[model samples]
Target: MVWTEILVPVLGGDNDAALLAIAKALAEPFNAAINVVYASPSPISLFSWAGEGGYGPTDVAVAAMQESADRGQARCRDLLASLDYPKTKFEAVTADDWIGLRTVSRLADVVIWERSVSRGHGFLANAFQQILLDERRPAIIADKPTKADGTIAIAWDGGREASRALRRAVPLLRGATKVVILSVPHAMAHPCDGSRAVDYLADQGIKADAVVLHTQGDAGQAILGGVRDLGADILVAGAFGHPRLQRFIFGGTTQLLLDSGSPAALFLSH
Candidate 1:
């Protein structure tokens, strides 16, 4: 699929505008149907608030939560409707008192989420992290509104996740005439082996050049420098692996790419 459906969360945060901009940009390429998801927090009962008697009664709290959810849904609808696209292309959905991550994963093709500190640190990060960690869908975490123009940098690690990301990014890659496949050296690394990734791209009719970067300092800084040198418009990379046991292990390269604030449309897949 070419990602004809896009999911944008309306969390009533400062980054709502950035999410909307991402939605707009995606719609241009995919003619995407936009889904505005609002995850209403579960209401806490008075019985649970034993220490704070000032906490409202159960019924009052329930009512307040419902009202807040209703307002959020309305606001999302209004914001999406105000866009340049047709209103029929956008829909508002509410997932109150439910598992937000599961709901988003089931319905969205590509999720556009925000990494905001002001949002208080619960569902926003958790939901996005879950989408990245569990779901097969590609996700774009908008730290700010991104302009999809620069050279597209593909972080190839020769893993399943990286392969999935490369497959999912075909549409974007096809449009980009200039693409670079980056591989970082490891203990098991070989020089000519990296050229196979370039060959794979050539088979798909995408003429890409592979450059092996030595694992010296920060992988993120090296990628940013490479992108700047190439004047890249976007960065294509796999989401990589997550923490499993107590060893703090991960597919390191993807984590480094995510932390890098290069102006690019991060195409991440698990």
Candidate 2:
């Protein structure tokens, strides 16, 4: 399947440009249409107090929220007009409620977002993570400003999540002239033979070589090393792992890969 419709959130920040660029890159390759969304804080519910009476401040706050939404929409429109793609379409909405998620899940074939807006507080990331896990649509997240070119690496771990990510990344996989599937051997995990992985891709008309690395090092480091050695432009892997107790913990491979500066498009799934 091809990604023909992309939903990108236009959060007012410095990273908005990077988000737009990613939308363009992924969309242009497939001739897709982009839907830009803006999110604003929802209006607060008002209540009448027993002693203190008036709702004057509440009314003023609601008006301010409305004004902010209007300004944000205008900025989004100007940004879309300045972009160069003719087929690139635009939509501006104030996601003051869960309607934003519903709109994206229902209308977008793929969601493109950044890791965080300014610091670690990433509204788009939180929104799209739920979308990817629940909506059954692919979400391409730009953790940092990444250049899309060079070799491509797929981290294969023989799990349901990894399989799902691999299936979703078929279009990008087909385009990469040089693809490598790196499987690391863990103590309890059954090692995947390179031949079997290669044969599986061959059936789907994709020819890729596999390399099994038995490294006594961190999985993320090994994967990054492979990327540098192979000159890879992107890395594809599953998003999360089994939760330990009440806290959610990502596998070492996933966490390290996320923190790296290798200039790769990570295709992730849970």
lDDT of 1: 0.65
lDDT (tens digit, per residue) of candidate 1 on 1-270: 466777776766556767888777766666767777666555553245654666555677678777876777677667777776752244434444335546656766777766442122655665666666666668776565555444678877676776778887776676666788877666234333357778877888877878777768765667667777777766776665544442135436555565556666577788
Off by over 4 Å in 2: 45-57, 93-99, 117-120, 143-149, 244-252
Clash pairs, candidate 2, are 151-232, 151-233
Compared with the true structure, model 2 gives a TM-score of 0.83
After best superposition, candidate 1 residue 32: deviation in angstroms?
Answer: 2.0
Tell me the spans in candidate 1 whose CA falls farther than 4 Å from its real position: 44-56, 87-101, 117-122, 144-149, 187-193, 246-251
Clashes of each: 6, 2
What is the lDDT of every predicted structure here? 0.65, 0.67
Model 1 worst lDDT run, 10 consecutive residues: 87-96
Query: Which one is best on lDDT?
Result: 2
Question: What lDDT is reached at residue 216 by model 1?
Answer: 80
Tens digits of lDDT, candidate 2, 52-78: 655444677778877876777777777
